[model samples]
Target chain A: MSTSRERVLARVRAALTDVPADEPVVRPVERPYADSHGMGAALEVLEDRLRDYKALVRRVPADRLAEEVAAALERRGASTVAVPDGIDADWFSRTEAVRRPDSRDRPLELRELDSVDGVVTACAVAIAETGTIVLDGGPDQGRRAITLVPDYHLCVVRADQVVDGVPQGVRRLDPARPLTWISGPSATSDIELNRVEGVHGPRTLEVLLVE
Target chain B: MSATFLGIPPFPEAARAAVNDSRLRHNLRKATHTIRDKRGAVVTELEDDWERLRSEGAAIKSHTLRHLDHYLEQLEASVERAGGHVHWAADAEEANEIVTRLVRATGETDVVKVKSMATQEIELNNALAEAGITAYETDLAELIVQLGDDLPSHILVPAIHLGRAQIRETFLAQMAEWGVPAPEGLTDDPRALAEAARVHLRERFLRTRTAISGANFAVADSGTLVVLESEGNGRMCLTLPETLISVVGIEKIVPTWADLEVFLQTLPRSSTGERMNPYTSTWTGVTPGDGPQEFHLVLLDNGRTDVLADTVGRQALRCIRCSACLNTCPVYERTGGHAYGSVYPGPIGAILTPQLRGMSSEVDEALPYASSLCGACYEVCPVAIDIPEVLVHLREEVAAGSGHLGEKAVMKGAEAVLGSSHALEAAQRAAGAARNLVPRHLPGMAGAWTDTRDLPDVPAESFRQWWNKHEKGQS
Candidate 1:
């Protein structure tokens, strides 16, 4: 009748009996590596890294944000776009496709997102060294599903949000929020370790950086 | 869906069969070399900082293990506060039962799975099938493994042993039995194979209400579970399901959220050799309107505590399962994972399997000897697990075990002679006099050594006697 939890904890305590009785449980963690891989122009380097992952990267001035987003959508020949509820409305105003706003009360059905051609949202932070963008369910970025179920993800990253590496990016985010770090489109290396783009998540990741 | 690896032979016997399969050897060589080269390149790009990063990774894991019971309790409290249910499983059976029951509670018969080594270690899919629940493997490599009715052969790529042509045949012949059939004219191309898997699992992802996952790391402070993967199959299973069950090992915990920065950098670089893998998703507990509404975490021990009991062997706990060791291992490159006879394979497997499962069975007993003590695994390990040291330590445990009476007797006799210089000298002199009678193949207790190795010709005078006469003296 003994619960497995108690039994497991008992075994663990007995196993670690060799650990000192008087020493502090938590020790200061040593971090010898640099905070970031030092390279000037982190934003420009971020663009290069993103493109290396086969992601389409475009840097547009703040004034042309809507034009750039619409052009990227048009290139994909998207007929409909699923936009997260709190994203910048102006970013998609110039697009000719019908815009479907995510429901506030409930999640959009998988079939509904499956039918859409593209999705666009704002990123919380970008790691320039790895060419990665993180999505924390912000006002612009809805839940995890809106960007996931769609075939294409056109994430918008601002230059000010670019960090030098992972440490800087982690310092700026909240772990309580659901965070998704995406370097490129969904890819698989299961077949002989050869990376092939397009899988369960978005098949194509297009990043638009506004200065 | 419930294929068991019961009655599998010990490591040496299985390896004997594996090494002879030239096609399998070729497949393994190609796959491992490709990943090894890629990992080497990416790791080298970090320049001088790589070694420091590896040391810090090892130190962090060691500190966690020193106070594991404390961190686990903290992790439990954090998880409960986040509106998630926490279950502790002492071993594989207990963990499997907990997960199966959670799924049945949802009243859903179909579940989708991400590629989790912990689930594979516990054989959760088999346990669920026993409870009349079907679990579909959504990872492309895992799907190939399930369809082919075989065990996972590698940690990263489960189907590393199967070439493209073999996979094409598996898809054309087996995909229909699982769900959607392969499209007409499917080729051996990797893209076609990947596309076929994507198509096959898409409908299942949309429909399945329950998901079973295993996490790479769990933060004790935030109750967050992190999963890193190259494909989005993990993301699909993680996001789509209504009920989520994650089975994680107790050792997967790191102290704080910031600790993720180290592993997130090292893992992707060491594992698939990318600067960052395609997707990494971190979620804590349940969100009201997003992803899974209910969450359950089953923390598994499964002889991990027993593993921690040994001072030298406990270093194996530092492993993050990046599989850099496997890719660099010479013995693993030839013999393949099937030789190790456990869910974990390669150098890490040699030490880890025996500790987790104990040295009771022939396979577990043979595992410590599977390695050549090359130290390549240690050099490439992101966490710096000294696999060769653990192998020798486990070999001592096996030698001192109940089954090896002959080996024990030989060691006792060796202790008598080797312990005393006089006894050693007399024995050496006697053998020196009988030098001409020495055989190429030794007999009796010594045959085990001499059958595979030639006995050295004894000199006219032993070292001690020769040294006594000359100034190069042994007093």
Candidate 2:
């Protein structure tokens, strides 16, 4: 018997017999859409959009980011926080929560990760238009599971990392690494089509934007 | 008994029953309208760029479909290079056998699932059960459908046909049979219901060794598969499992990684009416210690090649499964999804199902006529699938194929009469002479058409008679 791959490809070829044999394999896609929305105050729009999605956002000076991060953790009363490697240790200096540092070499077990009160990490890039933050499993992001299993997530975003639109954000990322794009706290419209926040992922998302 | 699409009535019969059920109609009306309004608001936010983005999206998909054979080969090669094993299945049976064997090889009996239409289309859960394996649906809506022994009715929310009160009852009664029990005295509040599901599925996500999923998009250049979802259950299944198998339709491919920019913006607003869904996860293949250690991508055809064969019907393959058309369709709003009798329902389904399954069965034959050609589905489609055009095309194919002999004969008789102006004038005079004798409804097979419609009132005389008399008086 011919392999399923060969058979499937044969079927596909036969199905497209109507197409000209000399047609080009790739055609340029027409992109009349704008690359960015050119928002005058992208950070303010980000804050507004994030708030609309039920995500808490705080903007602070670069020097005060650790203070804001510490205060946010304190506000959530997270005594045991999972901190990925490369995150600033100074950010946790004010908070008394025992930090569990996770890395690719020494990753926390699933059960331990689940038991943490929250996870703190840096974002690869942020889209202000959609209020989304992308994580690429960088040194500070550790692994996908660490951020997912916890009930609370505190993501720190530098002002420079924010983009004006989805297209700009997509252009900045490397697909080779696993990426998670989060707009807000996990939500669902599955129940009677009403939007309800707080499902499986972090119920509370606190973003500290350092300008 | 578990709900199955098999042995279901055809569209007209099922739709008649659905239209009369006040409760189902009320639920569907409320759900579709709410999403429709939300989608309008979000799409309007990008008014200047929305049309351009839509056109670009259509162009990209059209180009990809034309060169699907070349892109599929590239996708296969890229995935293999990314440390993932690729399998090809020409149909559902072959796909199921491959998945079942993969699970058994892991020596695991329980596997968790994300909400996947492809899996639902193939009835993978049933096949897994036959192989002595259990599949747990972790998405809240899917879990409800599983627990209540019901079929999914909507593309986005599977249980849209059931109200919150019904959901609470199902959870309270059936949740225990599954892993966890619902809290006592559970109310019908959506938030409370969501909390109960969170507690119920947390343990299973931690324990399941293998996971099943479907991709929203697969990039040929990067070998990456992306899944966009609102709930975090998808995150858990994609992240925590030891072995992961993704069943993807052959048409879900984009040529390059950058092609995601268009869909990433349009899909969320079109489907769930959000700026962006809560979670969008993209992974090329195995990520060693980060995600699943072993990755297997099963590429499925399942009669898609047959859909591609038709020049007119092939546009349905560009669908992103957004459900935007469903929300905007007036006929769908009244009849709900169950009446369509396919895993896919609504306008896209009406055109897609008949092509994929072939117009052999009554259900498939009935689907093409399910629409009223309102054009709302085409207006709202993100990729711009001309749903109404396809409906007409399929309708013509069905009418020309078999049955409908009575209707065909009537059309032939009309054609013979209308072919001659003299014959038409005489027939019109005969109809005018017997105007008072005509009944309110036609008799025989034609009565079915007039059952829900009124025949036009006949004039006292034909246009020719009136015109001739008025001309003589003027002369």
Candidate 3:
């Protein structure tokens, strides 16, 4: 009869009871480097690194962003796209593709969305050095299954949302939230030490470096 | 079909048999070295704060273990609240009985499995087999191990002792007897082998109604269980089944989601040398219609409470089963997992198996002496467990009364000679006088050591005699 929140809190308390309350929770330290001239240079470095990991990156002006995204989807020949509730309407309204909201659908509908070519959503935060995008199951990110089921994911992130390192990202995240940190596409290696890509999760990831 | 690691021979006997096989040694050397080098390179890339992260991981585990009783109760209550059942088992028999009953209640004769070492340590597959239920291993390595009818030799790479050609032979000969058959004339190529395995497992993935798993970490706060792996097989097994059962050891609990950050970094890098694992499946209770409709968690003790009772030995429970220590161990490299005579093998096995199952058998007693106390395992252990220190402690325990009769006698005789200055001096004088009579090759019981190595020549004069003739005059 106890609520999920109560259960989680009780466990946390018990696990931490033996340690001193004042003990510092250590966070990873970021290595020092020369500061970028501005957010643009940092964004460029992020884009470069993301490209190095084989993530597709594109830059668009604020006014023409929706049209560019729609065209990108069309180029991939996608008919339907899963859209989070908080995503800007103009992004899909301007496109010819059908938009499916993750909140209103059941498992069957989600499976249907998997057959579609892609899913587009805004990210909570991005790490530049590791080329990781974190989706916290917030309104924009929708359900965890939405991004996970789709073959291709197009995540939108503003330049300011980018952090220099994992430690900085950890500081910004709430521990209670459902967080998914993605570096690149899902991959695995066999016993013979041969690497294979795209077994589960997203096979192809396209990140729109919207400034 | 017994769950015990009983009737297993001593380490030297088992290893002597394995080392003579040139093919097994070649496969083991190649696989272990490749993984070792890749792990070292990736770990060195984060050279700035690697040690700090390792220390943080160890501290978090230590903090959680110190209050495990409290966290475990909280977790049980939470699971109950979520309409999921929780069962506590003290040993392997109790655990197997609980699971067998649960599965029997579900009226299912088959169950899918995630790659879980705790379950393997208890030999759950064999237990289930005796009960007339079939448990399929979904992890590729585990599948290979099960189908080949062989024991796992390495923690991560269970089939490390076999090469690609051997795997092809195993699949071609045995895959049909299990559930699926390999394609006609399957070659020794790695891709062909993987495609064949994929085809073989896909049917079982879609059909199995019940699933069993072991966790990487269990968050007591939310009663959330996490399993991280490189393949999608775990995700499929976790989500598709109607009823899911997880048998996790108590030591796997972490305080909160925040504590997961340290392990997420350390485990992937240390185990597979990857920056991140491909599939990280996290589920809490039933997610309505998203995953398995019914969930049961069997929290296993299985001599863990005994391990936890020992202040120094308790750190062995902090292991995540990453197998980093195994890859880096020199002893494990030459002799392999089969020599350890237990499911848990290598350096971790040397310390853990003896403690979990007491040093009551010849194999268990010899396990402590399996290592050279080289400290390589300690260096690579993510939790910073001083494995060599534990090995030495177990050796002392074995020397007193816990070891085999022959070993205990040998230690006692050695102690009598070395324990006193007069006895040691007198023994040294006797040995020096008998130098001419000493044979180059040892005879009888001592021959095993000389078989692989040359015997050291005893000098005509003892160091004591030489010192007395020269430097003693000055005194």
Candidate 4:
């Protein structure tokens, strides 16, 4: 059996063959003002855009992060939360809600996470221009099922982690990683052009932009 | 896959029949306009570096296609490493045979399906039906199409051609034949339609142990297959089945997980005009007892390599099936997908179907001329596939064939006149003398051009004569 690593390398070699060796690896393009702005500015812009698209956005800080998350959970009346392995233990140390670690949870166990109030995890990268957050099945991200099962998800992203463009973000990731990029809460607009959020994945996504 | 464009007709005949269907036109206009407006607004809102992203998307796809052989090898290795089996099929029949055999091995009579265009393109469900295996379409639009016994009319919204009333009727009449019957006293209300569909599909989702799917993207690095959908049905299909068979086009490869970053932004915006689709499902073979226990990915060629062989036409392979091009295309907006006479329709279909199937069939030959060449499809294309360029290229191929007898005659006459200045001068003089006899309307072969459109009143005077009278002396 061909290894995943070998497959990735072979594709990379093939894709890159046409590129001139001397060409700059990362070419910068002029993004709109909202895209080129710094993380804080971009986050606000994203908030506005999301609101325009009818998605709700809430902001929280690092020091009060756990309490705020707990409060958000309480507001939604969640009984349990799916916690990724890489999430800082301190984030959940103060919360009273039961925790479900992604690694140990089976489908049935994960289904319980869906009934629980919400899911909380850290994002791999967030694109400010497009209002997107990417989650690789990294330490903090956990299995793909955890975040998807819950109705609500509170994804935390550090300001430094946000990127202006997809290419810049792609440069930082390894091909072998399992990446899930999200822009807004899961949504479908089949009925008379009226959008219904939370069809399969999280119905509500609350991003905690920690400065 | 064998590149054979067999048994298809030319565009004029197909479009001639379509334009007469007023209901189809109304359905198309409503659907395309709504999607076009939504896509435009969302895209404009996320206009930050849209062009850059488009270029990046194109580049990534181009890079992947160039090294597809390598990537396929890598993806196979990764899936195997992850305890998954990989099978390759050269054409639709081969793919159908392989999938049928796989399902037979599992001894399953029914399989739930995720919204997969690849399977639709190859008509896998029908093939399975011939083998006495039933395939249930899980996506809402797909369900509508399947229940109606109709072809998909749009890439993103497969049942865009069906209105609420029509859906209500189709559901009321057809649901019992499939498995579940629609709720009694069903109304034309959208909620009722959705609820009936929901209750009906939920049973299948819960019951089916085998599922078939098509991937949005396949990451070679991790042997991961990704599927993006608006509904949770795809998730259920991918996760609930005991044996999951994913039939993916070979062109749907991305080198790494990171490469997915570019597409995630481009696809949702370009397809549904949303910031992101609700469900983005990714899996690397089997995950022990978590999802499907036995996972199989059938890598389908089905004329993709033939598409790859053409330098200009090969770019059609980079399509993410976003359907932005379809929504914005004027011809597609009017004639709809049915006119193209293939699974793939609209701008991408115009270029892709011809290449994959070749300019052999009347339908395949007619596909290249289906577009108006207005470049709207090119502008909305997330990957920036110069579809107009490809359309013209395919047109040239079609024109070279014997089918375009009238156009060939006109071209030959024009070439002869243009080849010699004296011959052109003689023709221009002859045209001036014959202006009265030019007949406001042409007969027979040239009549179709004036059927729906006004033939430009044959210029009162030839351009050469006018230029000579006005500016020749000044020069």
Estimate every model's Cα lDDT from 0 to 1. Answer: 0.88, 0.91, 0.75, 0.75
lDDT of 4 by residue, B51-79 (tens): 77788788888877776766778889999
| Residue-level error in angstroms, candidate 3, position A41 | 8.4
What lDDT does candidate 1 reach at residue B207? 91
Q: Rank the candidates by TM-score, best first.
A: 2, 1, 3, 4
List model 3 lDDT by residue over A1-211, tens digit each: 2343244334445434445666544324332322211224557766765675566788877677788788789877888888777777877767888887766243435447657778989888887655677776677887666777677888888777888655666557653444566766655554655455554556677887777
Which model is ahead, 1 or 4, in terms of DockQ? 1
The stretch of ten residues in a row with the least summed lDDT in candidate 1 chain B is: B445-454
Alpha carbon lDDT of residue A132, candidate 1? 91
Off by over 4 Å in 2: B410-443, B447-475
Better of 1 and 3 by lDDT: 1
Clashes of each: 0, 0, 1, 12
Tens-digit lDDT track for model 1 on B1-475? 5566667787756876787899999999999999989998889988878887888889889989989999999999988888899999998998988888888899999999999999999888888888888889999899999999988888999999999999999999999988999999999999888889989888999999999999999999999999998779888889888899999999999998988878888999999999999899999888768789899999999989999988899999999999999999988898898878899999998899889988878788878888879899999999999898999989888887865555667778899999999999999999889899877666666454443335788899998888888865544
* Model 1: how far residue B324 lies from native, Å: 0.6
Index of the highest-TM-score prediction: 2
Q: Which ten-residue region of model 3 chain B has the weakest summed lDDT?
A: B445-454
Candidate 1: list runs displaced more than 4 Å.
Answer: B404-475
DockQ of each: 0.71, 0.78, 0.18, 0.20
Fnat: each model in turn = 0.80, 0.84, 0.12, 0.21
Model 3 Cα lDDT, one tens digit per residue, B228-272? 876567766776678989999878988766566678778978888
